[model samples]
Target: MYTETPAVVMRQIKTVNGRRMIVLFSRKYGKISAGTSISESGKNKSALALRPYTYGRYELSKVKDNFYINGAEVLRSYYRIGEDVDKYLQASYVLEFTDKLLPEGEPAEALFDLLTEFLSMMEERKQAYGTLVLGYLCQAIAWSGSAPDLGVCSGCKDAEVKYFSVKDGGLLCEDCAGKAVQDRRLIFPVTVDIIDVFNYLLESPLKSLHALALREDLEKKVRNILRSYIAYHLGIEELKSESLIV
Candidate 1:
C-alpha cells in the first residue's frame, strides 16, 4: 500500500547495508521508521526533504509490515536553525525529546502541530533558546497527559504550595512537603516566580514564547526540575542531544 502524509524528520541512522533508516513523526501515523536509499546530499527536492528539521510530505510504500520512502517534498525546512551552534543544539534536543514522547503507530496530531510550531519559532529566535525549550517541554508534557499539577497541591489539595514533587506528580503544600518522602532529590523548592512561569508555559501558546524572557537562573532551575520529573514519570532517563545543547 502507498500513502502520503505530512511528516517531520526526527532522526536518521545508517544501516550496515548502507540504507538510511529515517524516523519520521507523521500526521497519519505517529512515529514510523522507513528505509530509503535516497541521498540527502542529492540536489533534488526529495533529497532536501529527508534531512533533519525538515517538515515535508512523504510518499511511502508499505510492504506487509515495513515502510520505505518512495518520494517526498519539503513543506518547510528549518535550515536556518543550523546556522548557530546554540540554536542547532537546542533544536536537536527538542527533536530528541519529542521523539521519546511519541509511540509507534498512534497518531498524535496535536503534538505534530506543536512540534512544527516549535521549529518555526525556534528558527527565527535570536536569544534565550533555553526559555523556548522549556516552554516546549512543558507543553509537550501536557500533551502526553503527564502534566504536573499546578492548580492545587498534588498531595493534600492545599492552595498554598511551595515545592514541586516529582514522585507525588505535582505541586506540594508546606504541610504535605513536611511529611513527604525523605529523598531530597524528588522535591524541588519553587518560588512564586517559578510557579507562575510553569502556569504561563502550560497555558499559553508556543508562538507567544518569543516575547517572554525568563531569567537565566530561573530557566536552569526549571529545566533541572523538569528533567527529573520526566525521568521519573516517563521513564526517559537520558537524551543524547541533551548534552549537546550546552
Candidate 2:
C-alpha cells in the first residue's frame, strides 16, 4: 500500500551507491526511515524533496514492514536557514530533538506543525538564533507530554514558584524547594519572568512568540533552565549542535 503525508527531512540525507535514504518526521507517521533510487540518468524527482529541512508531501510505498520513498513534492524549502552558520546550528538542534525524542510510528501532528513554523521563522533570519531555539525547546517539551508547569507551585499550590523540579516535572514552592534538594531531585531556581516566558511558550502558538523580546543574559538563562529540564527527563547528557552555536 502507498501513503502520503506532510513531512520534514530530519537529518542529512544519506546515499550509498545509487540508493538514497532519509529520516523523516511526518504528521501522519512521526519518525520513519525511507529510501529511493537515484536514477543513473539523473531524472529523480524526489531528490530535492529529500534534502534536509525540506517540508513537503511525501509518498511512500510500504512492502510488508518497510517503507520507501516513492516520490514527493516540496511544499516549502527552508533553504535560507543553512545560509548562516548560527541559524544552521540552532535549527539543527531542533531537528536533533525531534529525531531523538519522538518515537517511530507515533503520530504527532502538533509537534510537526511547530517544527515547520520554527523552520519557516528561522529561514527569515529575523529573530536571534538563541531565543528562537529556546522557544522551540519549550514547545517541544510540552508537546512531548513532559511540560513543566510554570503556574502556581505544583507541590503546595500556594506561595510563589521559586524552583523547578525536573524529577517532579513542575515548579516548586519555596517551602518545597528545600525538601526537593534534600530528596536529591534536580532543582533549578527560577525567576518570575523566566517562568512567565516558559509559560507563554508552552501555551502560545509559534507566531505569538515573535512579540516577546529577549536579551542575551535572559536568553542564556532560559537555555540553561530548559536544557537541564530536558536532560534530566530525556536522559540526554548534551546536545551536539549546542556546542556549534558559539
Clashes of each: 0, 0
Please name the candidate that would achieve the greatest lDDT relative to the true structure: 1
Return the TM-score for candidate 2, rounded to 2 decimals.
0.89
Q: What local distance difference test score does each model get?
A: 0.91, 0.80
Candidate 2 RMSD to the correct structure? 2.4
List, residue by residue over 76-189, the lDDT tens digit for candidate 2. 988988888888888998898778888888888888888998898888856677777778888888777888866677888976778877778888888888766444537778
Candidate 2 regions with alpha-carbon error over 4 angstroms:
12-16, 39-44, 181-185
Model 1 residue runs over 4 Å out of place are none
Minimum summed lDDT over a 10-residue window in model 1 is located at: 237-246
Residue-wise lDDT of candidate 1 within 110-198, one digit each (tens)?
99999999999999998999999999999999998888878889877889989999998889999899898658899999999999999
TM-score winner: 1
